[model samples]
Target: METVEDVTRMHLVGGNLALDFVNTRTGPPVGPSDDDVLTGYPELVAWGAYAGVLTTSEAAALRRLSRDDPDGADATLSRALRTRDHLDEIFRPLAAGGAPSTSALARLRDDEADALGHAQLEGGSTYAWVWRADRTLARPLRPVVHAAVQLLTAGALDRVKGCGGCRFLFVDESKNRSRRWCSMDDCGTAEKMRRYVAARRVRARR
Candidate 1:
């Protein structure tokens, strides 16, 4: 039942790539459901392109590579989801002023190291992570792991928030730092209607 528009509507409002990655799954803050938008390798590659982690040509190449090596593609998708879950465990607490678990940190460390191993120096001073156009199934995850590292190390952890309705993670970059919903067009409107109905019911009772 997924349409092109629905797939294209993947939330990018997290303000941070890694937080956006975690928002792929839709659910509550504590119990995010299994409704992952990246349902397959092609979807994952499309999301990578959408996230700016992969160029259009790179996404096309990855699609061809995945078609050729289904097993590798499956493994890569599994790794990507696992990485997202680890990030959820790590960042959720940090956003709440608590420390991440040692296990979660260890997983992130391993992902970061893996991502680094495939990188190459590009433009003399800037390092560009390169995954083989043919076989590097996990190439898309490198940038995501890097983004998570940046957010964790920077002073931006305090701005991370979960949407009040859907629990999607987003960075509250508002001037007042009072952002609460994942998107005003979606969860925000739904929440507003719920409150309006509740207030009307109270008035009717009175």
Candidate 2:
């Protein structure tokens, strides 16, 4: 059974928080069979904790709220999914050297505004954005929204990349920016095995 209370089981290769959130969906990016790790509000909360965006206490409180208010929880989940899709629209196209849909960009801009409304700038020596009202179901997404905006503004757009072997998106933080595939352990290994098998089959046919 997929544990709704633990999202760390899912891959987190995106390097950027926003990209990791976008990577929650698996399989071909455009296909109907894409699997989503965030199935319910609990999983969303869990993912937040996994991503270090939410504290364990915050996640627990949200899970309790989900049990008390199912409808609202579902609505929040819908919002998360919508935000995720917008991110995919923006980053996925950028990864492919194309433009994102204007509408998606607009929506994500609005999302950033909403996120800012729920945040406060707090720091002693260095300032940092922090979320308030941990009880709110959308708390987890606040930081994610900021992360998306930060990534877009960071002048590192050239590093945003989609995995060659999977639908996962990641920031190619390699010193040479030559990294490909989501991870060497998963997609890279699988591709190598595929090539090896094809070579063996060709030799057998000869």
- TM per candidate comes to 0.89, 0.93
Query: What lDDT score belongs to each candidate, Candidate 1 first?
Result: 0.83, 0.87
Instruction: Judge candidate 2 against the unseen true structure and give its global Cα lDDT, from 0 to 1.
Output: 0.87
Best by lDDT: 2
Model 2 worst lDDT run, 10 consecutive residues: 28-37
lDDT of 2 by residue, 46-100 (tens): 8999999988888888888888999999999999999998998899999998889
- What is the alpha-carbon lDDT for the whole of candidate 1? 0.83
